[model samples]
Every structure is written in structure tokens, then in C-alpha cells.
Target: MHGPEIVTTLLEMADDGQTRPTPSDAWHLFLSGLRQRFRLPSGRPLAVIAAVLIASIVGGFGAAAGSWAAERTFADLPSQARVEALTRQASPGDDYSYDRSTSAWGTDTTMGALTVSDWDPASARDRFAADGWQVTTVRDMSAGALAYTNDPATGSMTPLPVRGSQFDAVRDGVFLRVTGYVSPGHGTVSVMLWPDDTAAMLPLMLAGAVLGLVAGWMLAAAGAYRMRPLPAGRRRVATVLTGLAVTALALPAFAFYVNMTRVLGPSGSFVNTVHSALNASPYWSYSTPRMLLLLTVTGAVLAGAAWATMGRRGRSTPAADQIPTTG
Candidate 1:
């Protein structure tokens, strides 16, 4: 109980493996350490954190913008305005020429003189319903019935790594061509030039950003986040960046799941064409199932990371016990 004895005891505890700090003490130490390491006021670290988050999150969005803009260069996206202009310029004697600007990513294809006896987006929905085909992509046709599974209602995005036909168009009651992606798990049934009105892109973007940050942070944190040889500021950066990276990664995927109204859709045009083609050939098959595996794995990772984020307050915990270190 003497002052010198108390000093000896405290020094022992500081260096002792078994000694543990109380939660409150740990919190104070953690904050003081963080401030000293980051070389900023307590408030400044939060601002710095927000900046990285914005970079990773908003930068991820740049992926889509970049995708759309770059894709537009090679493949012109079909514009409603362009279609309208063509519809007007053509006379009864002249068949209207239309185009399906599926993705600015690629493919700038125009339609067959695809004369439109009538063009209506509203009536098209009715025609789709009558055919037992739901309106996945909600674009009105100039003169045919076409719909995709991924709704183009919510956002302007194409399903990740688009699997099957990217668009659908039906001409003259018999001619149908639906184009989309056919990736490993899910395939696409692109009814319009874009992806789901569903929010897949946002999450995917975050996943990419988080992945980048996690990777970058790992390199930094391996040396930075520790109790020894204090890399101090870099350590704090690693920690904050890590948290920001994780949030960036998980938020987007969460948005997709919470809005589970949409699925990776297939094209009704493809379905009808297959039916018609089967009537003639009697045998053919091209099927793609749920990207659920990717979704599942992604969900597991994001869920685990999110869980870790919630639990990881004011201290570092070894993660190997909670989840896999590598994907």
C-alpha cells in the first residue's frame, strides 16, 4: 500500500501478460492513444474517417459512372429521345428504324426496320401480363411485347458481370431476341439498357471499395495496429481506414438484401424464343441459376465483418476465431 509498492505493482501490470485493464481505463487509454497517434483533435479523426469513407464509397460509385461512360463510347445506349425522333421522322411508307442501346459498356445495335404499328409503354405492360410474363424491366416497346427480370425501375445499373442477354425485343409476333449475361451463377434478362431498378450496384461498389481498403489496411495494419514499437499515426489511420472500409463494403450489400424485391432476371423474349425454337427443333437448353452462391459468400463475409465492427469497440480482438482471414 506504500507509494513505492504501488508504483512497482503498476509497472508489473503494465508489462505483465495476465494483467488486464478495466473497460473504463481501457477506453481512456485507447482515446488518448488514438489522438496522440493520429496527431489530431478527437473531432478531427472522425472527419478524417468520413473522408476515407467518402472516397471508398463515392469512389466505388465512380465504377458505375466509369462503366456507363466508358461503355457508351463503344456502344451507344438507346435513348428514348432518339427513339422518339426516329418514330416521328418515319412516314407510313417508311418503316421506322429503332435501336436498343443496351449498355454503354458495349453493343450499339439498332433494330430491324422494326416498323411500329403502334408504340406504347403502358399497353406493353398489359401485353406482357397477358403472356404470363411479368414486367421485370419496365420499358415501353415501340411495337412489341418485351420484359426483363431485373427491374430497371430503381436504378440505372446492369447486374454485376452481367450473365445472360442484356436486353429483350420482340418483333412481328414471332421474331424475338433477348440478350444478357450468362455468368457463373446468375444470368441476366436485360429488358432495358440498364440493370435492376434493384440496388445491386451500390453494394457491389462498396464491396469493391471495402475490399480495396481492407487490402490496403492489412498491409498498413500488419505493422501499424499493434501494442509495440508504436507506428502511432499510421496505426490509427489503419484502424479508422479499416472501420471505414468495412462499413463501405457492407452497406451496399445490405441495401441489396433489404430490397429483396428483385432477382437476377431472365428475358421473356428469350423464354418465348426458346419455346418457339423448341417447337421447331424440339431440343435445346441454356439455364443459369441463382447467383446465390456469390451472394451467400458475400453475405457471409459482409455479415461477419459487420458483426466484427459492432463488437470491435475501443480494442483489437483476434479475428481468426470469428471468421476466415482470407476469402
Candidate 2:
């Protein structure tokens, strides 16, 4: 059309407020158009949301299952059996430490015999005998020292001199027979944490798992929204990377893991070996397995969402049909 024809047409369309928009108007219209297009599908987004809810439920259940499994798996693991009550925390004005590798509940070591502190061995043994306790077996690791191993064949006796009033003062003053590995300084004190029912701790693990699920959902939602839907292969890569990132950050979520390692070591310790690292950290009720449930489920859900949003890049979608087609 000629310049005048076009100008006249523009003026007429403008008078009625129906003119073809300029480039700046077009840019705004395009942005607005995208908002309308990406508005999640009605029933579809709900289905996705429902799927996430199901995932959370599964997560909670899964945590309980994992706890059950760990309980069973680690039950027969080399353990310490302690029947002694905690006399006090870090005993006031007294410094006593047993080397975990060198000490044991039932077995006496040369290290202990050599470092006889605070009491006389001859007197302790003599006192024990006077209390009507028949000494079953005494092994002399060296001179002037003896470790007596009592047998159950003997009747439940009263008390020994070495035990002192402090040991005998407790209401639960019955002596116990314990069996476990001997660590250096832990001695009789470290052998007590064994054979605790793992199932008792399951509920706590499951709670952590539940919390993990919520965190997973948020992470997945945020990541899925941030990533521009890509081609199929790229989408998979993105999801995997996102899942890994989530997994890597998991350790920082708890100060306990740090503290646990500092104090507990490979198998963990019965004593307060890790006092320095301990902190007043809030722990999730079922944090452990719950977090696993969250991360896995969330990552999986995000993967699916990423897949749905990232169809063939060059392809068209039915949802996009409502937009005006241009030649």
C-alpha cells in the first residue's frame, strides 16, 4: 500500500484505539503472553502436586523402614555392654580417663595394672575377698597386680571393698557381667552402650526423613522454576546435576554429623570424647531417613517436571495453540 494509504489506515485504527502495536508495545505484549502460556494447566498441576504429597507420605514410611533396617544390620555389630550407672558428669575435682584401646569391662590390661592410681591394688583385692566374694580367677599381668574374673556359678554376692560407698550408693547397686571389646582408656566405663534396641530410634529417623521431604519439595520446585525447559537429553542432565547438588549439601544440614565424627569416631564412643565439637544444635525428629525420602522423592518429582516442561525444543504444544499464529 502507498504511504498515504497506510498513514490513513493507521489514523483510523488509532481513533478507535485498535492500531497495530509498536515494537515497545509488542515487547510488553509478548511478556504478558508468556505469563498466560506458562500458567500451569489446571488439573495437571494438581496432579503433580498430588504426586508430591504421595511422595512425602512414602518418604515418612521409607524412613521408618530404613531405621528398621539399620537397627537390624548394626544390632550384632561388635558392641559394649554396660550396666553401671553414670555416677556424674565429668566428675568434679577428679581427673580420670581410660584409654579406649587399652581398657575393657571383663578383661584387665597391663596398662591399667601399671598405672594404678588413686587406690592400692593389694588393698582393693583384699577388701573384695573379705566381702564374702570367692575370687574365681585372678590373672597376674605383672607383679603386685591382679584382675579377677568372676563366674556366675557363684551366688549373687553383696559388695567389694574396691567398689567403695560411691559405687554401692546407687539404688541399682547390683553388679553386672558385661562382654565387649577393650578400648585404650574406656575400660569398664565405655562398655555400656551396646545392644540398645535400634527400633527405639526408628521414630526419630523417620521424622528426619519427613523433614527431608519438605526440603526436597522446596528445592525441586525452586530448581524446576529456575531452569528453562530444555531438550530431552539436556533436561536429564539438569535433573541429575540438581539432584547431586541437593545431595552434596545434605551434610551441612546437621551439626551433629560434624560433632559425631569429632567425638564418636568410626564406631562411636561411650564417653564424652567429643566435648569440644558438641553444640546445642536442633535436630529434626526423623531427620535422617526423612531427609533421604525428601531428596530422592523431590529429585524424582523434579526430574518428571523437567521432562514435562522440556519437550522437543523446536516442536509445538497443544497448549500454545490458543496464541495467534503468524506467517
- RMSD of each predicted structure: 20.2, 17.6
lDDT of 1 at 145: 29
Give the 10-residue window scoring lowest on summed lDDT in candidate 2. 104-113
lDDT of each: 0.35, 0.35
TM-score of 2: 0.24
lDDT of 2 by residue, 1-327 (tens): 123443444454463566576777668757865554334334447435633643454344334333334444333312121211121120111233332231111111111111222332344334434554332232232233223444578855433223211111111222211121212222221112223233334344445467546554554444444344455677567656545533433332333233323322443212221111112222244444245435446655655655454443343332332333459
Task: For residue 144, give model 2's deviation from the true position in Å.
Answer: 23
The runs of at least 3 residues in candidate 2 whose Cα sits more than 4 Å from the true structure, single-residue gaps closed, are 1-146, 149-212, 231-233, 245-327
Q: State the lDDT at 23 in candidate 2.
A: 78
How big is the positional error of residue 174 in model 1, measured in Å on the Cα after superposition? 21
Among the numbered candidates, top TM-score falls to 1
**Native-vs-model 2 lDDT?**
0.35
Error of 1 at 226 (Å): 16
